[model samples]
Target chain A: MEESNWEPKVIGFLCHWCSYAGADLSGSARLEYPHNIRIIRIPCSGRVDPMFILRALQNGVDGVLVSGCHPGDCHYQSGNFHARRKFAVINRLLKYVGIEPERVQFSWVAASEGPKMAQVIGEFVEGVRKVGPNRLFKDEKKDGE
Target chain B: MENRLKEEAGKLLKEGKVDYIVGYGKGTVNLRTSPLITNKEEDLEGLVINPFIANNLSRYPVELKGRVGIVVKGCDSRSLTSLMQDKKVKREDLIIFGVPCEGVVDLKKLAGQIGAEIDRVTDAEKEGENLTLQVDGSKKTIPFRDVIFDKCYGCEHPTPLEYDMLLGSEVAPNLDIEKSLERIKELEGMDAQERWNYWKEQFSKCIRCYGCRNVCPACFCERCFVDVNMPQWVATYATWQDNLTFQLIRTLHVAGRCSDCGECERACPVGIPLRSLQRKMVEEVKDLFGHEVGIDKDAPPVFSHYEATDPDEFMK
Candidate 1:
């Protein structure tokens, strides 16, 4: 895999009240994970529109992770539940299109799960590395390479 | 055709009752007549009714300014009825010239049938029952039932269910309804996991163009869920899961209000069978409330009126 010469670019969308705080705890605890991930904080995981995921793929992101509160622990009470249903539907669609489902990940992360957050990110980064960069929609007709 | 409708339109336009008249006119494009909007009397000469016209002109009334006179066919009038049902347009807003349409032809299907490309076409003659179509180069006569849209084939009513001015002789309503509901029945009968898998396969290919919503007459919300920013329903990704969420939510919102116009299915560039999904909801509405949209202008929308005896099949 080292000789494959592929670096994965992962985009993480973490809900503000849960996953984002868990991520902050991971940094505070000095936990180490792959540094290839770029995090975008959102109000709630439910706020992540499906278009955001497609746009990232179109812009050449290798993998996308959407982390929110656990099923029953969403700050807004039922936001995570809605997000779960949405992710299930979107995940099934990607599988149908022959896109490796591993490229998209959904996880439940509460504010206290610092070590778990680091572990999740590390596992996602490793999985993405094995899968390699997503060149599925990358522009091949660049005027100057 | 109704002489009263022409007289009313002519009187309204002559009296400056409307800024323009929007109706079906001669096809300038290949084998397809479009919704023609006119401010001049000369343009009204092109108006003819036999039933090759197939456009929902309801959207123009919402967008265009000033008073407008519109010709409403059976399905086209349904669009108007839906708009009125939703309070989107008022009866006094414009003059309506209703045409009793047997059914409109599906131009896309007709184009495939005839090898020769059609530059322009119209339903020129109706000899007893058969409709004669004059295309760019040649004239082909086809049985009215054979060439019209499938939705129209099973049409329970040939006259505009609601219209201000009746233009043509009203044809007896053809009550063959379930022919269109067959596919919906097949899908609804499938087990949950099977249905899920089937839909997963279908929604995965969707590009999320919003064409289905845009073309639907019932979906008149100024700001759709796709544009909502407060708590976005789905991500802006083309991924299968996101597309599923978008469609499921949108479909649920339009459950009872949809008239099964088939515009969503036609507008789909990738040719997804959206009508099947829509038909399922239509069945549910009928089963629950015995309510069919656009059929009766007096009945309140299903969602707007709650029933104490509503089914709780999906409720936990």
Candidate 2:
């Protein structure tokens, strides 16, 4: 638990049509990105409920990233568009409740954007690292044990 | 006003226009009222309209099965409008008896000022800007402004905005949206850590009573996420994290649908300042989506519809 060795635990929810493919492309291209993220493949960004992000944070993830297809490029036509609206409300709500806005990030990564996907992940990990661990939702009793 | 309310209820009952009228009856304790649903003309005598009538009758209509008549204040009417907009209640099934409100008093504040536990409030009367309360055979005069709930101070609708029949003369709304905005701005000025600590301390006091959610008119879901066990969305425990998660989820769920009736805050046993959380979303829905809930029946909810030009400054 030394400060210099500390690495944030991040959860990345990648939509199947675009962000998932972009992540796959990153792996195939062997691009270097932060190893902290644990990816959860979802059908589409619209399927990612705000509860999922909250649950992840409550269970002690340091950060969460929801990556979807570009708004117009959604595989389900307007799924990403709907998700964009939902995420906007959710983001503002989290910030209003005093949670760090940087901890929960949203992005649009196309199926062809391998380098961009890697860069987004790298940047998010670094941002979360600077904020240190998410102590807001951590259970102190469990931590002590 | 009480006689007029009883007369209306009697007429509606005798005419067979409504299955039952939802109104307020004297609570077992003084200075309190309870929801009373009655179909009999004789029961109409129990229907009362006083400054102590704090229960929102709008919540009863949704669970009712036939044509129903209900008495509503300005805030209750807004909640009814939201229910209609959400398709939870049908206008054709409702016969609204609107009452102009001069704001309701917070009994706690009144009791605190008196410096004694009130065994019984024998009589209560409001004249002009003062309320004379006969508590335990002793009369005490308190300014109406001093005893009124905080929600009523800047009440934007003293008269029902939408009603089938008006029971009294309309009163002008005391606009308080600016005051709400100022408080939000003050909170925004605090650093993230300070804000987080503030909420953490506030949420830690929650007892998991769920009174806030139960009393809210907007929380009409058949299966609330917290009750869903197949994939449990939130812990049922009263830990700060669980309480915070439950509150955040509930607030987001009611973002565009909340009428700011202050029922949740009023019902909260812990006095968690629930309205602050709700008003934040209310303010944001207005600023970011250009939408206000329960104002127009035709308009879709703020989140249900979005313009392509909606702000996306946070997205990468």
Candidate 3:
């Protein structure tokens, strides 16, 4: 519960073609963002199932970030569009069930949008920081151990 | 209505029309009806059109092969249309007899209202908005709304829209939307953390029986995600954490397909109000996707297709 030692752990599912390249671009351009997120490269945003987000939360991750190509810019053609529809429902369901809106986030970052990627991560990490640590979905029996 | 249904069922069996006639027959227990699956004309004599015909016969025909004649109420027909969209069952193979349902009684609510066990009721007759009952030797009357399931208060179609034959005339939809969605409104009224704690306690009582999954018509997957050990999408134990995860995944899986049949809530042994979560999602799907579950036979499944102009305010 000490303020200095608490850091939010975020899991980012980055699409292979766009968001992953954008992350690489941000690093190449010498932009500094919060190092809170651990990135997982996925084939496309459509491949990110709602189960993945729930599983991440269950594993005690403080937040989940699903980054894909913009609405019309998916490499596989409409994969991001499909992802949008799925995330809309999942996002609403999670909020209705009482999960904080800051815990799970989605965004668009193209390969050229290195500054946008840096900015998005900075904002997301700050939001997760405000929400603090994720103790909600963890297995309670294992806490004392 | 009872005699007409029996006569029609017998005529079909005599004509060698269907391999099975799926309907409800009088159960051995008082005030309970069991599903009747038979090919004989004699079994047609057991058919009863009581308010207690609770089982949704739509899912029963899924495992049965060959031509089938099944009885369906308003909500059940919507479930049948959903199955048809999924290509799970051929519409031509099914000869559906639609029953214009007033509503089915919730025996627990009935017992609670009477301040006695429901088994004491020897006769129940529905006359308009009043329900006449004979409990032991005394006669008591009550309003139908007092003893009906909450889902019935939100019934959109009392008569089946998709049926091969109509057993009765069309009945108008009598909706008490606020009454049906009372539990949902209560959840919505809570702060986020309180809502989470409420569900946490509710799912904690789950015994991992998988009764809700088995009874859902939309959950016809050849293999469920929880069954996979390679990845172990969910732990195969009774921890409240895993149970909550399992239910969350299950609810998302059935978002646009579930017709709010209320079978899952009835099947739950621990008395979890599973319908609260499901019914909430049903309204969410309609608001976001502009799609109502199983209402249109020609429409595609919600998740399988996407619109270019879908809501994306949730995304950054």
Candidate 4:
């Protein structure tokens, strides 16, 4: 297959105990995945404030993926659970305001699910490509002044 | 109603129950009311209630230091509840004088009807359904419905929902839930790109005055995210991106907390239809979490506490 000229810029906010470890394991296991995502490790998914996702979009990132531990599996016992509820409201609000629903994605990736993390990244990049570059709230300041 | 309000306010001050009364007094400009804080019994004469009393006096109790007797209409009373929930003001510190509101006039709408700048409104009175306004030397009497603020048309509580003392008889709510949701429904019917363009046009007009934020009773944060400089949560520029960020973040911050008092919309100088954004969140909170803000002070904020069975259909 010919490589596409477009490469979507994806920002992944990964919980340290779960999704971050999962991404690291994917690296150690040499599982190939799209290089589109730039990972930001956070203490817990609950720490991923909706502002961060919105800021990333405003800064012209093509997509945002927030991954945390599955329910009942959070290291802090309830962080991911709390994050799940917040993401639900944020996602709905974004969609209601005319943002592409696919621009912001949420999922659960346990520490051991290295291949799963790779799959999530690949799919998110593809989905964002289908929607094209995000112009919603994009900063209009010219690059490098 | 005005005489009763003044008498009750005087009684509260004369009895030394409150250090001051937060009510509306005559503004420097005619036909305008300003938030007045007074402790003198004689000053109660300045306290007035009219269709022009658009100021929400709820935030005064939180900002002022001392026992305050605040005059609250239905919407103002709800805002007081939100303040109490946030611990910004204590119930004991406030002597709430509840007034049954018959809707306040929208100054802009009235100005538009008159067709010229109102240099001064010599006199104004609401008699039954007609608003008699003495503009300059000519008197214009318009139907009250034609000049009343849009927020009042769908008021669910025309009288204070909760108050220590009732100043007047309870008024029946002119509750039109559909009317409140009409704008939201219209926006929802638009395609995504159309909606985006619509908001972009609106946000582009923002001057970043922060009038909406300042007027909100729920926006009691000591350091708003927009003002933070260390990590700059949102840029201070007047660009559309920054304006959109400020609005979206502020809405999220007040989700399940905003009382839908319409103060933000009323305070906006550019007429951004802020209530539309806020009401959308209000409806979403009600639909998803089954909670309405500023109703029960005992209940925790919707986002602060989550039920085990809270809907998570949007989650993976």
Task: Choose the strongest candidate by TM-score.
Answer: 3
Question: What are the C-alpha RMSDs, in order, of all predicted structures?
Answer: 8.5, 1.9, 1.3, 2.5
Query: Model 2, range A1-145, lDDT digits (tens) per residue?
Result: 6667778999999999999899899999999889999999999999988999999998889999999998678888888878887898899989988889889999999999999999999999999988888887865677732
Q: Is the docking of candidate 1 incorrect, acceptable, medium or high quality?
A: incorrect
The 10-residue segment with the lowest total lDDT in model 2 chain B: B174-183
Number of the predicted model whose lDDT against the real structure is largest: 3
What do the candidate models score in CA lDDT, each in turn? Answer: 0.72, 0.86, 0.90, 0.85
Candidate 2 runs further than 4 Å off? A141-145, B118-120, B176-186
Instruction: Show the colliding residue pairs in model 3.
Output: none
Write model 3 residue lDDT over B1-316, tens digit each, in one string: 8898899888888898888999999988788898999998988999988898888889877889988999999999999999988888888889999999988998889899888887898888888888999988799999998888899999998888799998888989999999999999999999999999998999999999999999898888879998999999898988888899899999999999988889999889999999998898889999999999878888898988999899998899
Docking category of candidate 2: medium
User: Lowest summed-lDDT stretch of 10 residues in model 1 chain A?
Assistant: A136-145
The residue ranges of model 1 lying beyond 4 angstroms of the native Cα positions read A1-145, B2-7, B115-126, B133-140, B296-298, B313-316
Task: Please report the candidate that would top DockQ against the real structure.
Answer: 3
Rank by DockQ (best first): 3, 2, 4, 1
* Best-to-worst ranking by TM-score: 3, 2, 4, 1
Error of 4 at A86 (Å): 2.6
How much is B110 displaced in model 3, in angstroms? 0.7
lDDT of 3: 0.90
What is the C-alpha local distance difference test score of candidate 1? 0.72
